[model samples]
Target: MQAYRIDGVVRQGKTNQDFCIDLVAENEDQVREKVYSNFGSRHGAKRRYITINSITTIDPSESSAPVVVSHFRDK
Candidate 1:
């Protein structure tokens, strides 16, 4: 399985008024889908949260390392 990094101002069991979105997705369409899915759906059908932040796309520097980093951040 592959992992993707998502960065957003997640509201714990609530909605963020001044929300923002920023993160890396599998593709262009996945970007909107991911955000909507995560924000709209409840976590484990219990906790609800909204990602009000930006997500950054991260790629592995090397294959051996499992570390993922991106220059995705608020300016």
Candidate 2:
């Protein structure tokens, strides 16, 4: 798996909020799918409400999320 940084905006009830999240996926397309599923379950957010602006492939050291860091560190 590779570490990715996903930046985007989510609309909920007339409110739009920006979001940045770190995730591990095999590719950018997988990252998008994961993001959509995660947001859907956690926030009751639909795919249409989520706007993914950028999907960046980042080095392990550059990751801010501990889980991502740990996954790479342990490997």
Number of the predicted model whose TM-score against the real structure is largest = 2
The true-structure Cα RMSD of candidate 1 reads 8.8
Minimum summed lDDT over a 10-residue window in model 1 is located at 66-75
In order, candidate lDDTs are 0.45, 0.93
Q: By TM-score, how accurate is candidate 1? A: 0.35
Which of the numbered candidates is closest to the native, going by highest lDDT? 2
Off by over 4 Å in 2: none
lDDT score, residue 29, model 2?
91
1-75: candidate 2 lDDT, tens digit per residue:
899999999998889999999999999999999999999999999999999999998887888798798889866
Q: Give candidate 2's whole-model lDDT.
A: 0.93
TM for candidate 2 is 0.92
TM, every model: 0.35, 0.92
Pairs clashing within candidate 2: none
